[model samples]
Target: MTSTEQAVETFDSLDPTTDEVVGTYPVHGPDAVAAAVGRARGAAEWWASLGFAGRAERLRRWKGVIVRRMAELCDVVSAETGKPKGDAQLEVVLAVEHIEWAARNARKVLGPKRRPSGLLLANQAATVEYQPLGVVGVIGPWNYPVFTPLGSVAYALAAGNAVVFKPSEYTPGVGAWLVRAFEEVVPERPVLQLVTGFGATGAALVRSDVDKIAFTGSAATGKKIMAAAAERLTPVVIEAGGKDPLLVDADADLDAAVDAAVWGAFSNAGQTCVGVERVYVHTAVYDEFVAKLTERARQVRPGEHYGPMTMRSQLDVVRRHIADALARGGRALVGGADAVGERYVRPTVLVDVPEDSAAVREETFGPTITVTRVSDMDEAVEKANDSTYGLGSTVFSRRRGMELARRLRTGMTAINAPLSFAGVAALPFGGVGESGFGRIHGPEGLREFARPKAITRQRYRMPLVMTTFARTPKTDELVRRLVTVLHGRR
Candidate 1:
């Protein structure tokens, strides 16, 4: 084999449940990442030249391929990540919807539009268009591997930039499969390429020549990725860890709130960045709500409703949080420390956990939730806002759903529902504070992978010219008057 081929090492992608190797991928190092990005830089031009209509057609065809093979992809995801088949399919379904939405809406979102010039510059016509930012580097998370990464990948591709994806070390197989599917649609160029390995490989991609990086992972990793990208002054969109909370008002529908809380807290083994980690219920309905929630949570069993924790290392984190909560005088209404098994974490529900307890304050990316009783909606909102992460949140109230949702400090909020914001491709998705910045879905997402280009042309010249050397004191005085007339009283 050539040295070029020998230089790249191989790593095994194991089934988290069985610890059996499901697939093996090359451990692409810094040199390999650089080569992939170099190729993407060239491919980006061809992709951009295709224009919106051409790219849309290609994306539509690719979407068809994904839809047709949805089951196959779901199986691969389940095997690699240890999620249930239905949950895997649900993620793929959402991913396909986003791909379709990005394809159909990119033109409207990123296309050029006329801008009104100020009265002083009325003689000029201004237009601003979003242009492709060449290559995009996407570092994806393992949880919801297909859906989360595609939020960046599909949008970036739709916006006319080529993507070089570095999936999590745990889900390289899924990433490779996605790239291969894209290759079938756009076989002409390296429009989408895959680089799989550990954190070093992701760091390499961050430091490469890609125009921007869209990273979805832990906040600590996001910081490291940001620092690496800073060396090249590259832009980044971070969808980091979130300790999301759910609020239930006194007038909320008890049944609906219970179902939403259980699903949001336990889905994907609670590995979701936006999954509900804390619940604050109005004291009037606190007893009833906790009773209903615990009953529903009891019905959920690991390896059936959900699966094992995908990352073995996370088991310890979950155990620590649960143990800490108990140690701090928190009571377990449903599951306690014993819920965290060797491979799986049973649905754990803790009550009266101290606000400072790790279970309430930290991002316990496991099947765990903490419930607290609040005096009213105000207290609930205040407690919900008391986190460094402001990612996704849920509000359940018949009368004050929207009101409470707006009060909570989060990027996206679901009123009387759970995680519905992610389904609507028109709404931007991301967070504030430690949850990271920039958006990954909707119009904002399309623009995230693009750069704005502003253009102006002199339609006609004014007699009182302010920008030319030919201007006199009279022109300057006239310009001052015009400015005063337009804004002096404002």
Candidate 2:
């Protein structure tokens, strides 16, 4: 699996539906990952030496490359992950937009800026600057291969750090396509490198001496990655799995809400980290909403609209969740146990499932969603906020959309839309609880890949200096008086 020469050999990426190899990519192991990181270390220095403007130019060029070759890359992504070409292209388009935003906004988000040192330190001039953290190791997931990873990759590049990307084994070709395209514009060095393999390879990347690691995957693997990175005290940004909820209020547009739930839950075979795994509909509109949702779910045929599960092992997990829900008296409104296919899981919509069932409590990561009836909007908000994972959520209502969206404890909430928060490049994306920490996309993404360096230079020596042994009892009394004058009212 390790590289022998500059030219690497090939490995197969299979199509889940046919169990056939659709594309071949280089299988890179620890040695190769380490080499790529080393190269990235050098490239990062060069990229960082170039000021913000210089980096922006190169990033824009990379963006152009992605835009121009969007179709070719989408074809590779489609073949590797078994996703429809349209879906692949959509993800790539979003990724390119993110890259462009990161490039244009990096200087404003991360450059040195003046900050007031508070009344106490008014004599001192304070400035804060975000410095690039040498190299970033990004371990991406198979679902939304382009968009998800670029949430980290684009920001890292724009912030002046080179990236070593280890995409999911199922989507290695997509990863290679991205890195190759990046090289076409920024060919001075390996600013972006691809390392492709299984879990062992991902573990190796986390253990490597990279400055920071951004991981998107299951929470179990996230814990392992965190433990590995802790050995070196390496900071990490993890966007783990989520059991996200889409709340439908009594006043919500039933038609629009149904459309969002179906598309959000079933799209991409329901393998999205922030996908709508749970739906809490207001009891006032429960029956109507469920009927609409069920009808819409039936309209989405797998393979044509979405792809088979890229990871074969996930099928069992999906089946077990369905079986657990069914055993607990949950009725499948659409597809049931038989929906779990050899490769693709048909859209399954279940109702009356116990809240504690695996399908509700765990991250299903499949084309299945649990529809529960909540008494009112308050109950819907409560139920939605109860999950341990709080990545992203959706709220649909006419009058109370924004208010209810703010009440949910998730990191990002979309009002009257599903996952729309992610599309608005200005909003930060990440999660609290077990869903993981640190942010990707928006200003937060730029800062996550950088370290804050606070600088304070004495403008002039103050008459009352506190740092030296030269401070007298009289000066200490005067300082106390000054502090009292400032804080006594508060």
Candidate 3:
């Protein structure tokens, strides 16, 4: 059967709040995915052939199209993710800004650069440049559909690679619309394509003959994707989940810290990978801080401030964590077990939770946060750095904010601000340890999708060459003397 006919299976993307069908898409299998990659190979070469200036022009135009139809795209994002219109617009705006930044900075970041030849190799000239790795397979997450995936897609394209994206099954319509937007700007080739389905489809794309793979999801799924890509030894970038923390020192601005924590923990219903899941407050102001936080959280509603949990499976996890914490003697200062409703989860804040409890140790991915009391900023840093996840962190301190932020063992940190690193296009986004390796933003992101090429040219022959078989004993003696003169001083 032809590739088109082989995709007989189909699925519907549903609204999380009402279970309404938003859009239906074909469940593309191995054959369909491979066909898309094969087509992308040629497109990648054609795209690369368009030098830096040419590609940047087209990318800016794509950004224009997205900007012009921002409302329509935001509607699609809101429908699929069940997020508020404002939240959807925020993510889309960030995505477009990244696209524009990547397009404009590619030449300066990836272009050829001169490398100095040492005194010993003065006869040689060296230069370095980054080249694209052709086709890339991007397996995106559903939480921040447009923004997360585009973190890789935009950089990969800027580095001159064609992309074949497999968006999460829950948000296929959003993926389809992104592909459509790209096609409208550059109608000549299939430079960017979409494949939608379940886990099997994602696996098929990973197994396909793609140059590289970029994924954003849980650590378990990232491991599976890594193992599959290992069969081909293909390069991969995995952006796994994070159980990030927010630290509040005794000298912190109590009001500002409370506000940042409320927004960081409850925004997006606490589905963000880098969202503040844990807050370590100094004992001096712990009670007062908790009171302020509780008051702020109570004012935030599910459907009004945020939206329902996009993934239904996360509801049970949130409920279990709350029950476990409560059973373990931790108290709920704001919402409790009943906060987890059928579709929406009210902002839940727990206090006096032990570090060993599941609610504090695991990723709840819901509208719940744990507040722990620390003796000092030192203890706060110690407890915050104890997580296997080192993705992002927030520090709220008037005097020691910058110092504490630098001490946190995370990829990025924000001081006196919430989720500030994520909004900055210049910062590198990724984590060490279990949070996953490889970066996906800033100049590091562009280099992640491309390979560095080092070139060397011989300027002229040396008067006293040591590499030739015809070298005399005098030449060796002179070289030894020069080495002694250059290194003996050290």
lDDT of each: 0.93, 0.90, 0.93
**lDDT (10s digit) by residue, model 3, range 26-56:** 9999999999999999899999999888899
| Tens digits of per-residue lDDT for model 2, 86-205 | 989888888888988998999999988999988767789999999999999999988888999999999998999999999998888788888888888887888888888888888889
TM-score of each: 0.98, 0.96, 0.98
Over the stretch 1-490, how does candidate 1's per-residue lDDT look in tens digits? 8766655579999999999999989988899899999999999999999999999999989889989998899989999999999999999989889999999999999999999998888899999999999999999999989999999999999999999999999999899999999999999999999999998899999999999999999899899988988998999999999999999989999999999999999999999999999999999999999999999999999999998999999999999999999999999888897998889889999998999999988999999999999999999999999999999999998888878888889999999988999999889999999999999999999999999999999988788788779889988898889889888995
User: Considering TM-score, where higher is better, how would the candidates rank from best to worst?
Assistant: 1, 3, 2
Predicted structure 3: lDDT = 0.93
Which ranking of candidates, highest lDDT first?
1, 3, 2
Q: What value does the lDDT take at residue 63 in candidate 1?
A: 89
- Stretches of candidate 2 exceeding 4 Å from the true structure: 1-10
